[model samples]
Target: MTSPHDAWLAEAVDAARECAHDESPASLEGAATRLRIHASLERRRGSSKRRLTVISAIVASMFGSTAFAYFTGWRPFAPATEPARPTAAPAIEHEAPPRARTGPGPSVPVEPPPLAPAAPPGEPAPPVLAAPPAAAPPRATVGPPARRPRVLPEPAVRAAAPLSPATTPAPGPDAELAAYQQAHDAHFKGGDPAAALAAWDRYLAQYPSGELAPEARYDRALVLVKLARWSEARAALAPFASAPVGAYRQREAARILAAIRDR
Candidate 1:
């Protein structure tokens, strides 16, 4: 049995025994406990690092989101802007006051010249007389005592006899007739109807029953017709119409009256 393989196995067994004899159980247990403690400490340190990274990521995400929202017009925490203050106006230049106007100065007083002395009284004045003229011769004067005899007025010539009632002249039919004819001619032939009518009316008022009265009335009616006085024309014709022997113009009056009534 003292072969080479056998010797090597024995040497290995002897070294193991020597190593087992040198190490203590207490030391081995102590080393194992230290290794467990180191492993646990390393695991705790790794976990703490991972938790810190996760927290940092969450904080960065929130900050990015807030910045994005702020750029998109969200201003939840923005302070209010103040109104701008107005600029003050510049001061204006002032003009000096105008001088007061002064009129002319006071005038100096002047004294008047002295008056002359008064004259003394009591000097006597000279007297004056007028001369008389020579006389002329007297002539014979015709005085009232040398008067001539006078004849008396012939018994105060008795006032011409007072006109008696019988002597008083009366308006005659001939005068009325002449006046009516004159008025008629004036109205018809002379072209003076107003004067003619006046004269006719006077004649009618003075001698209503004269021979020419019918002619006067007829002419007056014609004058009225010419004047466009229908009513007065009708009135003027009335007297002629009632007469038994109507005047020459009565027939004409009747014809005109008929024409007016028809109208």
Candidate 2:
């Protein structure tokens, strides 16, 4: 069965494969050299398949991730965006501020100069007539309350006799008088009991025996009674009840003291 031609060809092919650098050798049955070449080719093909499998697997993973995101509504973190602001409304064109009145301003109230003290009666009365108050500039408002006429009704006889020190009221319009007045005003006009309390305390501290001290003490007692500080009220009323410090309102103080005692 072994032919010489086939044997010779196989021998040539083996020689070429061993002697040549190129791998394109002729195929032959029962060729020992072909075994090594085939084994090398098989290894290259296996490596290529493995590389393709890895690349396919990577691609499939990326696709799967994309699909999951699309289905699940997952998105990359995006900072919250601010809603667009509405366009500003056109600026209202306000009339420019009224220019300062160019012409002479409204007539300044002309208060007539203060009149001297009225003379005593009987002697020819000096003219008290003030020119009809110059019609008070007809303000676009009610005319100011009638002002005291600058001219006086003729003064009673000569200037009033100078008041003696004893009969004259405590020469005031000073701080002490002002403080006492503020306290009194607080008691009646401010309508705040606590303010009245503070005012009286301040006034008394500065003026324990001032001319208005008795009146101040009496008013303070009344305020204390109103505030339900009956203990202090009773104490304050004690001097008045007992007539100490030239106390006044003894009848009222005594009755109030009796009421307190009964209570």
Candidate 3:
């Protein structure tokens, strides 16, 4: 079955392929040889670079350790013997501050001028006027009770209640005083002057020298005015009007007395 021409063509093709393979510079053996040469050059170069890096690292580490030791005073090159400390420079003697003149100072001590003799003793001192009595009042009297106004006086000086022996024992002075206030409100606020007057009289009888005595006496005088007892009212108000000048009751008593006199 083989043709002669086909066999010749096939042979020619095979020969061409063999010639191309032999002429190519990149054969497997040549490629291997190049790779080996490049690898050796890289090895040589890498070793030199590694040596340079190690030297640089050694230099850096030495420098850092030297700096650390120097700063920490661990390896300082200070001398063993101590250096002499310089002394302070001797002070030059400048001329003493110019002295104040040796003569007397600016101001001389002097005795105060003699005081003028006190004015010759004045004529014998005049006698001093006697002081007025502390509780003195101007002489005055109450007018007729019939002429008095119908209106009742204020309770400023009204009397407190009578403290009866029959009363229960109170816890303290406050309770006792409250009881007295209750009685006062009963008679005084009830609008009965007569009953109020009687209640006040009983209170005064029980506590003649009580804390409310002055007030009771004053209220009694007012009640007397209501009952047309002008003389009794004047007598009752007399003591209060004569109270010391600056006493709390003095001004009020004086005022009431004056009103009575005007009436």
Candidate 4:
């Protein structure tokens, strides 16, 4: 009986021997070529793996750098943040109380002055008198009854001739002449123009053909002007335009009429 361990070792050695014996030159050569190809493939696989590892490391580094930059607030093109503004302090509040003044104030009392004294009653104040000058001498007078005149004998005188009828005083005042004179006095001498005009009208009616007719008409026109009756004034002046130049108021009427026409 063989021991168990020796038997297993022997079997492993037999298998090794058998495998060597079955190998041939051609097979070895084929095996060497296959091994070389396998080795080249394995080298390629190693190179590929190394390259993948390098790429993975680069990608991981990029991701880590980006994450770190995001968390750290590092940005190449981003705008900078403004500093925070300081907050204003709250305002303090206060309450005001009414004030009370001390001590008494001054007083103002106004009083008027007394009136002047009154004069004494009755007993009229003595007249303020000027001093008298010396008295004048008395004038002398003579009595008129001392001298007498010699008397002459009286002679009877023939009666005075009877007064002629022509020489007798005129019977009455000339009515027409008196009226014209009154009108003239009222219109020219007196300042009352309305009364003057009324008197002139009466004179004209009583003595239309009197010598003073033209003069009366002219004065009437003047009064009419004062009365502001321009039309009637012009009518009064119309007759004088054809009157003789020597007429009393012809020239005056013409002048007044021309003035009226111009107006």
Best by TM-score: 1
**Best prediction by lDDT:** 2
Output the better candidate (2/4) by lDDT. 2
Q: Any runs in candidate 1 off by more than 4 Å, and if so which?
A: 1-160, 164-168, 239-250
lDDT of 1: 0.69
- Clash pairs detected, candidate 3: none
Alpha-carbon local distance difference test for all models: 0.69, 0.80, 0.68, 0.76
TM-score, one value per model:
0.34, 0.33, 0.31, 0.32
Global local distance difference test of model 4 = 0.76
lDDT of 3 by residue, 128-236 (tens): 5554445434334544446656887667975877888799653455643553564477456767777777777776666676666666677677777887777777778
Number of clashes in every candidate structure?
0, 8, 0, 0
lDDT of the structure predicted as candidate 2: 0.80
* lDDT per residue as tens, model 1, 1-263: 49544554565566556557767777556555655665576578778889999999999999999989988977669777998999999989898886554444444444444443444566444333333333333433433455568977676667787789878678676776677777877787887677777877888898788877766777778788777777887777766565565666656666677776532
- Name model 4 segments beyond 4 Å from true: 1-173, 244-248
Model 4 TM-score, 2 decimals: 0.32
Name the lDDT value of residue 107 in candidate 3.
51
Model 4 per-residue lDDT tens digits across residues 1-263 = 98544655575566556558768777556656655665676678779989999999999999999999999998789778998999999988776775444334333343444443554786466545454554444433433456668778789898999999879554234877788889889988999989999999998887688777777878898999888788988898888866899776778788888888855
Off by over 4 Å in 3: 1-179
